[model samples]
Target chain A: MSLTPSKRAYVPFVSVEHMMGLVHHIGIEQVLTDLASEIEADFRRWPLFDKTPRVASHSDVGVIELMPTSDGETYGFKYVNGHPKNTAEGLQTVTAFGLLAEVDSGYPTLLSEMTLLTALRTAATSAMAAKHLAPKGARTMAMIGNGAQSEFQCLAFKAVCGIDTVRLYDIDTSATTRCAGNLAANGLTVVECRSGQEAMEGAQIITTCTADKQYATILTDNMVGSGVHINAIGGDCPGKTELHRDILLRSSIFVEYPPQTRVEGEIQQLEHDHAVTELWKVIEGQVSGRTDDRQITLFDSVGFAIEDFSALRYIAKAVKGTPFFTELDMIADPDDPRDLFGMFQRAKS
Target chain B: MSLTPSKRAYVPFVSVEHMMGLVHHIGIEQVLTDLASEIEADFRRWPLFDKTPRVASHSDVGVIELMPTSDGETYGFKYVNGHPKNTAEGLQTVTAFGLLAEVDSGYPTLLSEMTLLTALRTAATSAMAAKHLAPKGARTMAMIGNGAQSEFQCLAFKAVCGIDTVRLYDIDTSATTRCAGNLAANGLTVVECRSGQEAMEGAQIITTCTADKQYATILTDNMVGSGVHINAIGGDCPGKTELHRDILLRSSIFVEYPPQTRVEGEIQQLEHDHAVTELWKVIEGQVSGRTDDRQITLFDSVGFAIEDFSALRYIAKAVKGTPFFTELDMIADPDDPRDLFGMFQRAKS
Candidate 1:
């Protein structure tokens, strides 16, 4: 039977540039601040999530991953690729996009680029951990990996935890120079450190976002002082790590989804029973965070799907007033659900 | 450090019509034949592949699914949705797309629409199963549920089996008329039948593809005669069944992935040890398909990822020599795998 002529179809989409414009339009400071709050809020209600470790398809050159998580009512997943050797071939090592769909109908509500969103969430997650686990009155941060993620980290700390200065260091001097140029003398007292050791000195928060797809000790125990909160961002897959073993042992480590962290985050080198605290437990008052001010603390940040969920949720809200977004023909909208084949003739494209 | 000049930026996407046009240009008959060969080849080496039950996300009105499979060097996943009630609202009951990527790089090499491809593969899979299972010299066929896929079923049988005529029936008379008209003046003889019983008279191959998403006894024991080959296609999800318990009891059952078939196929109504054979065994010559000419053979067909993989593989070959296709920006071309952010600025989307 022919489908009725009157029908409605929706193509909901948000492009990369439109999403970035929305971030700028709403002020990055406010965005990061709110993002941390959303992450923290979602984490506190952690029991609501159906948590499964990400399903990863690893390769010799890199890894492509699908991270799916649901809070029973909403389902979300991110399709991301991490190819460390891509930069040599003029490609970005990490590129991502994700979808947020309704659990009841499985209809995609928002499909958007997550490359920029990922940067925002990583920074937000780091700051969210710092807020619960870092010592009060922490004012400075040591950004060890001054690459694409540096600007977002600097801004996240500034907007969320009142950090006013950042000391940056990278193996490439050009990366450090470029990071500083993007900062453009904006508020934070930028110090271009010659080494990771130099960057960690006299810092309250140490954030590492290095991109090597190998086991790298970006921070050794000697470089990290007592009471410093290490926000280890890189070393996010198997056969990759950032902080040295001794550093992890000494600090009271707090992590997001410990099971996943043990495989992809800095804690991968440690034992299964190596006592660690979940950040959500502390945020929800289920467990204590930063029990002693002088105690060294660490946030083993392996990116989680929920943070991306929160990031997508935040973007949908922040970009509400903008007309920069365009829709993609992702879902089939037919005149009659039973007659799917009729769709081909109705929508020729 | 600006990534403004990175050479790893690309956005090549083939639209929906281009894919269909490519399929049409390649000729439908060739795709079916090549797909049959691919399915047969994959089924033979079934043990080498890592197979898992499909992960389904069900909803009130439909289900969105991700069927993932890999063979060490390549990874493929299909995103498909089945909404039987969608046509009432002018939406497709099913819409699908999938990706094929290199296992070494986790980079997607091909991204193609699977809505049409699915129709082709489903029919090809049925015919492939019938080749080994159906009794000798099966000519006339009874096709239950004449919808969009009716034409493919008729053609695949004519090509794979030596079927000379089709006896069709549908609850909706218009659908039956459409099927008859499409088959008219095209090689095979077409006849309209008043009921499922009427369609099965003298027909050796009885295909049941009714769209009711529930337990339906479309084929009763009395209607299913000796030497009848039942191709049950529509009973593909949980709570969906087509054959009566008695029909299944008297017939020899065959399936694709027993674990999944237990939940989604016609055997969902049967006991755990109902004694079904995997189609791979038959294709590989490891097991006997049909023992006697008078024995009732039933193929409880639930489409699998490998079949989709076979179809996608076949399509890639079919379009290899033609310039009728375009590529999607499914993967990034980064000079430095770490500089994914810089490529966004250069994407020219």
Candidate 2:
């Protein structure tokens, strides 16, 4: 018997190196623009996908989550972890990887390192939401929390929403300086501010992407003005909200999946029975987005599985015939599928 | 800056070829025996694990499941899929991979192909349960379905429980012939039987591991004699079972995790409130295993997450300092955790 693995036994793997190469080859801004459109398209047909709240295993120091979804023809899931303390040890606060499989054979088609992909997708998702909810003619964004995700968010908004300027702030000035330096050559006018209040000046959009696992308020009610869209992406776990209660009550809230947002999003700060529109409904034109120019629209942005699914789907296509992936013998396929032991015995030779 | 991945950025990956090499180097019987011991040790301290039913995505053609568990220090999860139609397409009916991460940092430390490891662990878990539940001096086991898992089950029982003989039978004579051939020189007295009743004639233990996604009786109630230990492993999904309902009623049933078993095991044929002993409880001495020699005992084995976790822990140790794994740059680690965008820019050269 031939010992070479069959095509069925190989899965295409995109490592961090390959992902970076793919991103740069496709151009980050172009990739982000395409990802936003792909996410918007998936959101348009959201009801066709199977949606469930992520399965999370929370520890005292961190949390690990598995977010899975399928669109009838394909299945996808992402394994991600959030450990705020990891940065102190020179590691990322979040790391991730994901898989895509064919629903027909239950075989994996793609496995990719999702740390970089997640960064791209999360920013694309934020920019996509803002495109629908942010006030028309909005060209400036207040980016509070100039940490790892700041530059990506700034660039995605520039690419997807036509925002040309970003006002950046963080509790640590070093992070703000780092963010400002990264955007210097990206064509975005970046202003580094000392405080959260200073970051909001002359900005039509507010994006909060802090990393504290607490209830500290990054945006008080008085700081958020009317007619600006708020993308609260940091308050993703219970007891870690970013917006104040008053700001939540005043805003017209929208969320990805209500069952998950009620537990993990900024809406968790609101009453359990508070009204929130599903983002897909608005994207599909079944519900209105930004009904009035002066309306306070809050996209309570806790990440969802479908967004990762969209990213997986996009990467699976984008890497085709490109030198952005290598094959791994991750699956075992015997000539006679039922004789797995015979295959094992033959390998003993 | 060095382009080489830092230690934290690398995760050890065990592929199919490496897994086979490791198994052959360590000997399959030794690996099975070691896996059984590891499973037992974990079952002895089962309460420390954070357990949940597998998150399953069911499609018309198949099911994909994520099984996750943590023991405070480490977290592990397995991604497995079952598509019976896959065999017809010259693919394995089941395929799997797993990950292990440190709970403190939530960083994935290991990624291993589990399609083969899963078969090993399942048999090990079965043999471990039979060691506690099987009658004293049980020398012969009737392996009713000679599929991919049959040889592993036979060898595991031989190594862990000292069963010197296995009676094999399958509806397909070729399968039975193949199974007998595989076990020929394995130090077991292999008997080829024409029927399930003939296989059970002189056996005190019976293991059923068929692969049909339906409710079909491979063993009738009248065929099962008193005082025999039954390992029912084939009835793993909803609407799939092997034994007659009357046989399940006559046996003193034990299960891995009741919540999962009630939905996916032979006990699904029974009432939702049926009393069944947990195998871990028996291993922990919190409950009894087999009360008398004349009382039928059934291990209704629907696999659980902790078993996979135990196997992961085992492989993580076994592959250390060995040529069984390769490091993949799966995690993106920047020099400064907050300077991820800077890392991207630096990689451009």
lDDT of 1 by residue, B267-328 (tens): 98889888999989988888988999889999999899888887776666666667745633
Could you give the CAPRI-style class of model 2? high
What DockQ, on C-alphas, does every prediction get?
0.38, 0.86
Q: Compared with the true structure, what per-residue lDDT tens digits does model 2 show for residues A1-349?
A: 8878789899999999999999999999999999999999999999999989999999887899999999999999999999989888999999999999998888999999999999999999999999999999899999999889989999999999999989999999999998999899999988888889999998999999999888879999999888889999999998899999999888899999999999999888777999999999999999998999789999998899999999999999999989999999999888888888888888888
Task: Indicate which candidate wins on DockQ.
Answer: 2
The 10 consecutive residues of candidate 1 chain A with the worst lDDT sum are A2-11
lDDT of 2 by residue, B249-345 (tens): 8899999999999999999999999889999999999889999989999999989999999999999999999999999889998889888888887
List where candidate 1 sits over 4 angstroms from the true fold: A1-10, A15-31, A172-174, A316-323, A342-349, B1-8, B171-188, B270-274, B316-337, B340-349
The CAPRI-style docking tier of model 1 reads acceptable
Q: lDDT tens digits, residues A149-174, model 1?
A: 78888889988999988988999988
What are the clashing pairs of model 2?
none
Residue B226 accuracy (lDDT) in model 2: 95
TM-score of model 1 vs. true structure: 0.88
